[model samples]
Target: MIIGSSERVPLEKCPALVLNADFRPLSYYPLSLWCWQDAVKSVFLERVSIVSNYKRKIRSPSFEMSLPSVIALKNFIKPTEHPSFTRFNVFLRDKFTCQYCGDKKDLTF
Candidate 1:
């Protein structure tokens, strides 16, 4: 379990969902998630604004607050209008299946 926090949740138990300035997910196919450390750092750096938070809290001699569950970038980043051809892109386009075998299980590569 992690320390110096109000909640004793394991570090891996919570990850903040990251979003673009428009409030849409940064990446839909894989879903953008940032670890707690990065989330907190982004908050402190003012690179991102917290949209939502978990009940869990972290504390320091100087400050104490809940961990962000969702965050959005302060500046907008445009997504590409077209996706490049790659194996991962192909899988996302194909819904992660082996087209020839019709196998959708664990097509991770």
Candidate 2:
């Protein structure tokens, strides 16, 4: 989708949505996104492939290129399995500390 903007678009609005090599979002909960600078760096490094572009383009002394709206990694990265939703995991996340009371002596669910 093309977003209309003025002569110059702000850098904050040019965040590139990062996707895996499989064309899926790297992170769904947080929504993987990289700034314009990182996106351009990745493109130059050949570490990522551009999937889509934004209407705005950035100009530099050497080159000028359109900002990428969506980018996928060139190499596929194995996805980490989700942690099991268990009481032990919950306790581990909490660092064995009591959530309700400040009592660190006894912690139980």
The sequence of per-residue lDDT tens digits that candidate 1 reaches over residues 23-72 is: 99988877999999999999999999998888788789999988888899
Model 2 residue 95 distance off true place after TM-score fit, in angstroms: 23
TM-score, per-candidate, Cα-based? 0.81, 0.70
lDDT of 2 at 16: 92
Model number with the top TM-score: 1
lDDT of 2 by residue, 1-109 (tens): 5544444779887899999999999876458999989999999999999988888888989998888888999998888798667776777778877788856676666
RMSD of each: 4.4, 6.6
Strongest candidate by lDDT: 1
